[model samples]
Target chain A: MSGRSHAASRLVVAAPYLWLLLFFLAPFAIVLRMALSDADTALPPYAPHFEGFATLREFLGKLDLENFRLLADDALYWDSYLQSLRLAGLTTLIALAIGYPLAYAMAAAPRHWRPVLLVLVVLPFWTSFLIRVYAWIGILRPDGLLDIVLGGLGLTDEPLRLLNTEAAVLIGMVYSYLPFMVLPLYAMLEKLDRSLLEAAADLGATPVTAFLTVTLPLSLPGILAGAALVFIPSVGEFVIPDLLGGPDTVMIGKVLWNEFFSNRDWPLASAVAIVLLVVLVLPLALLQRARQGREAQP
Target chain B: MRKASPGSLRRAFQPWNDPAAKPLIEFRHVTKRFGGVTAVAEVSLSLYPREFFALLGPSGCGKTTLMRMLAGFETPDAGQILLGGTDITEMPPHLRPVNMMFQSYALFPHLSVADNIAYGLKRERLPRAEIAQRVAEMLALVKLDGLGKRRPDQLSGGQRQRVALARALAKRPKLLLLDEPMAALDRKLREATQFELMDLQSELGTTFMVVTHDQDEAMTMADRMAVMDHGRLVQIGPPDVIYEAPVNAYVASFVGDINVLEGHVVAVEGDLVRVETGITGMVELDEEAPALAIGASVLVGLRPEKLDLSHDEPPQPFNKVAGEIWDIGYLGDVTMVQVMVGGEGGWLVKVALTNRRRRAARPFAWEDKVWLSWDVEAGLVLKP
Candidate 1:
């Protein structure tokens, strides 16, 4: 019976591995192969077509870094990459600044009200993502609902120029990802031992000092997880920028979309996609290594 | 049960004995209510300097609430809290000069043991060298010197507990509150840690207040303990005094294994009160009896160990009860025998006998007739 159960458990573990191997790894391999090929006006749009084993070997040997070299030579790609990093960083910071206190409040709420508050935080997810982004356009456009509300409140004399701006993109991104930032933070803060705060206060630490030394350091895992969740996706986000940003906002996601569909340069788009993945994965790997290093210590 | 330790025998340390001596901490009719339930009713208490005091009670008895009030975690709805004769009821927890060792230890998991001990000192903005020296001293005091670099999870339970103590003491506060400190330890480690905590308190000369439900822990470690029930203090005295003379039935039963027989006062002669009990026939008590009227209902309490049990009947002129053994439990060093007295509405009296010899045969068996006797002074008179 034990041996049979062991084999059953092994099969259960292998199911997800096989699924990922077929779907995720296979697609990534295809993209990598496309990234190495040359752009063309043919039906597939790229590559010396794979023929027999001899042609495949010859094609692999002849693959060059010309696409990456072209990307480096062009100022548009560089500007778009820098712009994407800046916006992603700003969006992460704003999300953290707004989400930390909100998550803390949710965790510190009366025990009976916690579930209700958590559901409200995640309530935005039930609606379609595109509809939510579109809903913001109605609020942000000049002489729209926001302008009327501001005029009635007498906070502004004139209708504000709010639509199709970088600020609007940032606001959309931060709002879209706020729940992702809060859930992890709420989980961490909720599980925090309240006595530690009392113990800190029992020491000479003030409330602010206690938060800095005890609460803040202990909740860092949640903060890092939340930031990464918001940062990596926002780096390559296409919808919010395309719908809310002005012409001046040249994010790499839009650049990659224009390269693939408008310019029909699949190889250049694949190279850009590869660079973006590398950019996101490097810091995440560093974070995992740092966590492991701390765990490895006595 | 035993003689007072030499360290507690000093007169200067015994502030409760002197009428003019001021208390270190005072709670004046403090009351706290949590929504509809009163977690702590109007209660007044005081603690003297360098005294290892204990608040003993079962769960939901307000013992923990009283300690939390002192720690400033909960504020009293009405009344003032005085520390060293200054009202501090309005002071926030961070401003108070008292530290607590939480029941869960609450050691910061993200920090090493050395860093945990240094947490409080760093708040004081002390010099770096002084902080390091103090941390090192605390590590040595807790006998966890070489294990300073380890996290709290990496250490054993006892070591983690000691680290919590060391961290709480690192600030050298005037009063250190311990909330069920031994609830996390096993029996053997608890007993050893209790003595170590006592020795440390005596050496540091810091006033310590411990809250616990274990009667043995209160009796063994506390210089004096306050027995609480329903948010009110029933009795407060040294362990010996409390054990020998409990003020009421609740204190008697809560403190240890006891047999309370309901009776009425039949006769009162000066300091002696003779009570008629259906279970034990007639018993006499040597407590002050002027306040007790004739034929008034009262409770007669007897400690299990105070009663003598034997197969042979006792001589005449002794307060004795004849019964048959219903059950026997052998607990390594001592054997507990439960005897049934009086026919239908009988009394079950528990008697403990020390097992002096390992190979000695059992003296009494189940359903065997036995006689139990005790002195007049052993019976504690209480109000019904």
Candidate 2:
């Protein structure tokens, strides 16, 4: 009976991991395979052919150079990449500026009020994310709520243009990604050695000065984690830009999406996919490494 | 704050108070409460220039809260905290001239030992040369001159404590507060550091307020100590005074091992108050305290080493009690023998005997009938 139970326990422990391997790990391999393989038409041609590799090589050789040139020559591709970088940078900065204060306020709030503050910060997450973005459409449209309120106040003669701008896209990104920045930063700041701040204060730093020297530096790991979290996805995001940004706001995700669906150029899409991967992989890897470095500290 | 202790004297001299060598810090009836529970209640104390004081207590006894209030991390719900006679109850911790060495020795991990010590000086916006020179002096004072390059994680527990000390002292605050400075170190290390701390205090001559639950740590370092229990100050005096003459049962029990015999005052002799105990026989204590009427119940606290244990009853003009040896603890320097003298609450009659190689000298062991006695001058008379 005990032996049977032991085997059952082993199976129970192994089940979740097995499920993850089957669902998550297998899908990534499929994506890699899909990235490599050529498309003949309606569906992937499933005959055994090293044609995928041949196509991949040829694709890598001249056409790949053209993709590179596409990024370099026409300012659009390069411009989109630059805009993505710019948007991501702006979003990260804005998120950090807003989230740090909110996280700090949450962490330092009275014990009873803390959870409610946290919930309010995270309430956006519970709401339909898509609905929130759609709500922004209602607010950011020229005759939208924002412009209507401003016009009512007689701040401007015409309804102010808000939607389909870089600022609008950044606002949307920051709103969508706030909790990601806050939760980690809050967790870190909450567990901060208040004594370090006291020690700083005792040592002769004013409150704000102490925060800069002690509290801020100590929570850097959490800030980095939040920044990476917001940065990684924002650079690759298509939905926010497509919804909020106008013609000039073409991002890498949109280009890849256009190649795949609109132009039906799977090879070109794959090539663009490869370029996006190249651009993102190094930083993401470095971020993961940095996180691991913090943990590795004894 | 007319009714002030040594700590209150230091409080009056705090930088924000008098701005000169006026007492440093003064606690004027400062009380703190956590909802329904009061942590520090209507307590007033002071600290003076270069005085080393201690707030000694058991766990959850409001000492830490008092220290926090002084540091400006905690606010008093009633009354005000005066820094050098100036009201600073509302001042934030960073704005206070006081610095604290935290119990955990909270050192910054990312910065090197040098930078950690230099942090406060840097915050003051001192010139680079002055900061460097001060940091070097601090590193040497803590005896970690070459270790400036190492981060806190690289140093041992003692080294980390020294770094924390150096850092707290670097800002040249009028007061330095240490919360269990040696608590993290092992027993041997803690003892060594205690003396080093005394030396450091003497060398620097800065007023220090240390909070510790360890009685020995408090006694060894503090010039004057205020013992607390259940959010109240039980006694405030020099180490010898508090130990030898604790005001009540709690202070005596908290400070050292005491055999408290419950009794009632039966008679009064010249400089001696006689008490008849339920456990021990008639005992005599000093008549220094407020006079107690006959038949009034009291407790006589006797230190373990003060009592003499013998196989044959000793002939002396002192109190004597008879009991059976319950247990024998063989500590190398002093062997602790527990004698049961009782009815309801078993009396822990402790007697420390010198461990001699001579067989004849080893008098009593487990289960042997023994007589425990002490001089009239030994035990203290306190009310429970």
Candidate 3:
């Protein structure tokens, strides 16, 4: 009976590892191999395609760092990378500014109303993401719904030239990623022991001071989790930028899309993807290590 | 019950008896209601300076609510609360000169023990040097000197309780309130901590009000305790007075185990009253009998320790009942023998006998015929 239970536990532990190997690691290996090869004008686009063990050594020898070197040589790639990082960072900050109070209010609401509020937070997920992005266009374009509302309210004299701009792209990204930010924060704030706040007040702290010293410091884990969830995906976002940004908004996601689809430079696009993953994964790993170090203290 | 020595400091301290003495804290007819349910109802109480007071009650008995109102967590719906003779009913908690040790001990998980103690000092914007000195002093006071660097989660249950006490007392507030302070500690640790808390309160000279549901905790630590029931103060006195002279059956049963005999007053002889009971025949009580008229229903409360049991009849003929032993519970300190008095299927009266001798042959067993007797002064006449 013990042996059977041991086998069952092993299978439970292996499930996620097997999933990562089949889906994440396998695709990442393909992308890395393509990133090292040269772009060609032949079928499958990249040169030195694998033909099993017979030509494995020759294929390995043919791979080089030419695509990575090209990425360094071009100023457009550098600008796009910086722009994507900047946009993703700003999006994360704005989401936190908007999400924290929203989550705090939801957590502080009546207990019976909490489930309904949580449902409303994820209500947008019921609609297709592409359709939601499209809906933003109708609201943001010149003389669109937003313009009409402002005009009717006499807030703006002319039609707002908002569509196909960085602002529009930010609006789309923030709108799409808000639920990811709010959910974690709400979960953390709701689980906070209210007695701690009372203890703070009993120890001579005003309500605002208690919030700054106790509530803000305690909810940091939730903020970090939410920032990571929003920032990582926003960095590699393609749909929002393609639909809402103008030519000046040269994010890395759009640059990679152009290389893979329009320019047909799959090797360069693969390099771009790898660099983005490294930039994101490095900071996340460092954060996880710092958290672990803190938890290890006596 | 343990009595204080004749010439000891505790024996001389009785400010509540002095009518001219000023109280450190006062709750004047305070009432608090949560929705449709009243949590505290017109409850008035006072604690003198340097007094160790306790609010003892069962769950939902408004003891906690009364404490919360004093701490400014819950505002009273009516009436006023005065601290140091000044009204502070509308004051917020931070502005009040009061502190509380939470039932959960609610220590800041992210902060170290030293930091937690220094939190209130920092709020006062004291100098860095003074804050450090006071934090060290508080750590030493709680005997957690070497554990200042550890987080609250790293400490044991008893250690965590000390940290909470230190943090609450670090501010040196005019009043310190502790809510269910020892509810989380194990039995042995709780007993030790109770004495430690009493000593700390006396040494600090700070008025401490503790809210607890455990009668033993209140009796052991409190100089004066108020028993609460259903949002009202039922009775308030010293532990011995509350135990020996409970005003009603509820206060009697709540404080300790008691055998209540339903009876009616048959005769009144000044301070003495003779009552007839169906369970144990006629019983006599030496108490104030002016309010208890003849034929009025009353309850006779007798503590188990007050009654003596013997295989043969004792010299006293009054207040005696014959019965067979129904059950014997041999606790380490005392042997509780339940006797069926009068006849079969009659009232079961408990008689507690202290075990003075070590492992001697059992003198009493189940199904043994015994006579239980007590003096007239031992029974308390209580309102039914």
TM-score for each of the candidates: 0.97, 0.84, 0.98
Clashes of each: 0, 29, 0
Candidate 1 vs candidate 3: the DockQ winner is 3
Q: Largest TM-score belongs to which candidate?
A: 3
Query: Would you list the rank order by DockQ, best first?
Result: 3, 1, 2
The residue-by-residue lDDT of candidate 1 on A1-298, one tens digit each, is 6999999999999999999999989999888788888999999998777788867778888677888888899999999999999999999999999999999999899999999999999999999999999999999899888999999999999988788999999999999999999999999999999989988888877888989988899899999999999999999999999998999998999999999999999989999999999999998999899999978876
Which TM-score does chain B of candidate 3 obtain? 0.96
lDDT of 1 by residue, B165-269 (tens): 999999999999999999999999998888888888988999999999999999999989999998888899999889888888889888988999998889999
lDDT by residue for model 2 over B319-372, one digit each (tens)?
887788999998987899998876335777888887777565566667898888
Looking at model 3, residue A279 earns an lDDT score of 90
Instruction: Give per-residue lDDT, candidate 2, residue A112.
Output: 97
List model 2 lDDT by residue over A1-298, tens digit each: 6999999999999999999999977875554444554555655532123456658655444321343445457766777777788888899999999999999999998889988988888788778888899899999999999988888999978866879988889989999998889999999999998767767776777878878878888899899889988988888888898998888788888987997889776655665666677787888788779878866754
lDDT of model 3 at residue B201?
85
Clashes of 3: 0
Q: Tell me the docking grade of candidate 2.
A: medium
Highest lDDT scorer = 3
Instruction: Estimate candidate 1's alpha-carbon lDDT, on a 0 to 1 scale.
Output: 0.90
Name the top DockQ candidate.
3
Between candidates 1 and 2, name the one with more favorable DockQ: 1
User: Residue A21, candidate 1: how far off, in angstroms?
Assistant: 1.7
